[model samples]
Target: MSPSAVKRKLSSSARSVSPPPLRRRTDAVQAQRAAQTESTNHSHKLNFYSWNVNGIGPLLQKQISFTPDATYPLRNFLKAHEWPHFLCLQEVKINRADTATQRRVELAANAGAQSDEPTYSTHFSLPRDKYNATGFSGKVHGTATLTRDDTLETAASVPDFDLEGRVLIHEFATIPLVVINGYWVNGTSNPYRNPDTGETQGTRHDHKLRFHKHMLDLCKSIEERRKSVLLLGDMNVAPTRIDGHPNLRTSPIQHVINRADFNLKFLDKDSETGLKGIDVFRHLHGEKKKYTYHGRGRPWGESCDRVDLIVASRKLVDDEAVVMDTDICDNPHDRGHSDHVPLWVSLDASTWLNQSESKVD
Candidate 1:
């Protein structure tokens, strides 16, 4: 079936399941994507970036132990790549003391503090309940989007199934460029296992599965609108061995390799699209072991593996999106950034708009 047709089918099916609030949000998202995709042609372009900044607190702390200064290194890096039209950031944590409105301003100021010009506008999704709580500080975890242009549209932060952090979305100048910033829950190596039931008995695994489902659902919904989608974030789960640690072959992480509920736990196994709507870090590099996570110690003390990822819709690839891995920092100790490396992809926004126009003719 055609890609657009596939999207519609998914939407119709999702709607059949209650079709009220979920349907409304999905429908609005679909319309927004469609409208964004049709807005401009070649003259305008969008650049998307994603990274997991482990925790903003450590970087902003008075005395830090890590090597590379997080604030300075990241700021310099952004300054160097100053031309990206749109940037998506995962793990853009915000302090609860600040309101959402206040947080965005702080982020913008922070970005500008590191750049000569504040070329990016910020958008984020924080926890709803936390914002409503009495004397609530602000969201603990979430995602944010930054763009050179002030054209980000209809931005929303869809809380994922885990209810841990936020997944963010926005349009780049109404062009068929819809960017999603995500930070999936990081898996716990020593999750609380029921002594009687073992590791398979808890809500941890279920939470991971729910996170994947939420991501897939969003991807499918966006595909339904047939826009060029760029889903970027710290995915936490490696789709393949190349994106995992080297020791995985001999002694694999049981939870990762097991296909028991693989289809439900990872994006590589969505039955309907079956990973069609997903692409990952492995797509850019065929390397292994080089990881993004370091055991909670110092930045480079003990390494885990690559969990961060940049996924693009197959439709976007066909539209000539220049997707690649931008492994900006190697040593978290040196950069004072997150355990994960920042990954970026550039899409020729004009190309999609122009091609769509041609098809109309």
Candidate 2:
């Protein structure tokens, strides 16, 4: 009785002590690691917005200005549509009379008073004259950046082009993005006259060539520094005659009307080989009316042009970037905003950084 019973008990204890199968243990370990990785990547999704608010003067004057009453619609839009992570504002002007401290305090107060969340990093790219000269003398013709200010990484603004304050660059997180907010000088209608040069420089001839060269140089510089870049704001040049109605044809300059060649040659083309640059915009909104600026005096009382654009490097598009709906805002009519729409685009930080690292080889 003792030998048989003891042997049976010993056999049961031996079976219980045996370790689980190797494959099963490996599967459990993998599942735990997968969950950990997922948690680590739970970063906030980026949302960006850009607008040329004509001139901030009309909204708020004096040393300090507030526009919550005027920006009610904008604030409402933000709450309704989920406010963006960053806002790139063009035509943000500060009176030359105000001191830097005065300007900052006033703008900050205005922003806070207007919206639920105020921008943390304020990068004001004043015009070239002001860039070197002191005081806010000439109209500050550049860009403004407002960030959530919650992120660990700080924000910065880079001026891509300095000729008459046409470009401003901003970066958020490790995402090195270049924002060129420009207002090119051009004609009023078909081919309007140059207020200064009259013939030598209008919307068509050498004026465009010179301005475009500067923009191209900026793009090249951004490419050299940042792995991914976005060239945006009021380009003022139509890519196709179809960009605006044929009946509104005001300019005889064929090139301005036909933007395909121009875009393909400089923007889409590779510098060395003269091949096409990435058609990033087309990839997102094809054939859709992405027109940002419009005219009011047409026969039908309405005419449109696609001037403002958000063009990204091929790498960003291929890796799946985000572009919000490009809609024309109503503030232009009342708040002295420019006759253009506000647009947005979101980039996946993880995807971009990973791809850039891989390309370093």
Candidate 3:
């Protein structure tokens, strides 16, 4: 079957439960294979860069830059370390009703490569007025993913929980990995009232919790298919207190609930039914006090939290030296300032991808 046909069948058949994925192979065997491959092979590495642009339209229009030194900030960022194979974004703030701009973005991204499958594939999940509790007024939540790799087979959103443009999942044929890029809802209960009717219906903490649940469910479903998952984006909830700085929650009921849920669902490696996504930054940094988001009009160091994350499945990272480096980066140029900085990871794709398909000629 064609790749598209296979994607369609998978989506339609997602309702039926599949048998659990088989247990991983022994680590001794994995290490033997890793010893044969160079950990520093640039050709066998895939670099994934993720940032919640806060508003992507400005970046596209050149109205803003991640830094001051470059006219095209994206170009500067791409070459900052290595070429970013996949650029995953969050908080795109694009409304669902706007189709014109979406089409334009696709056109611009694939301008030169005009094939049925362009050199770049872009997918955006935007918020719709009918689907949002606050009625999708002003810039809200959204997510997008762009990839130039031809192995990208499908791009999709979470089934029932995708109305707010919070999640985007990409499946690639050449790799044994699924990428789940999400911009999770900030935990808030602010209500938006109708100007005249005084009828109020805004978001509550429940909405945020439900979004987390749906993303986890999607991860579980994908893992059942025997593909490792890389879940990355602005998850919003800090799993531990150390993640927050000057963290003035002082133990609010909301914090307690949110933290506990995150711990069990994503952080807990022992949970038989949880997503079990290993926190890549924490795993590498080891309680290092670094922050990704600066809030409340505070400078980065004074008040911030590492809300942005890059979590990978255990199966994908178990091999030694798969994760080359993971770090939280700040703006090198002083021109434009965004609250959230970029988080990136470079990994040896050959370590996890099937050896036969790992190398691309």
Best by TM-score: 3
lDDT of 2 at 2: 15
lDDT of 3 by residue, 1-361 (tens): 2222211112312212111222343677445433332222226566787888777665554425355432334434444545476778788776666666555454444332212221334566666435353444645777777664332234454455576677777776555678888888777666534434656645556666776788788888888998878888998877787988888353558766876787788879998878777899989889988777875375547777788899888876675457778888854342144568888887776543445333432
lDDT score for residue 64 of model 1: 36
Scored against the true structure, residue 292 in model 2 reaches a CA lDDT of 62
Model 3 clash tally, residue pairs: 0
Tens digits of per-residue lDDT, candidate 1, 272-337, equal 554465454455555534566565554353446665666667665544554533443456553444
Error of 2 at 283 (Å): 2.5
RMSD of 1: 10.5
Clash pairs, candidate 2, are: 158-169, 190-250, 190-251, 191-250, 191-251, 239-259, 268-276, 268-277, 269-277
**Model 2 TM-score, all chains together:** 0.63
Q: Give per-residue lDDT, candidate 3, residue 239.
A: 76
Of candidate 2, the 10-residue stretch with the lowest lDDT total is: 1-10
Q: Kindly report which residue stretches of model 3 are placed more than 4 angstroms away from their true locations once superposed.
A: 1-42, 62-71, 103-119, 129-138, 149-158, 191-203, 248-251, 319-321, 331-336, 352-354, 357-361
Show the colliding residue pairs in model 1. 36-174, 36-175, 37-176, 41-350, 42-350, 68-333, 68-334, 96-137, 96-138, 97-137
Model 3 lDDT, residue 175, Cα: 52
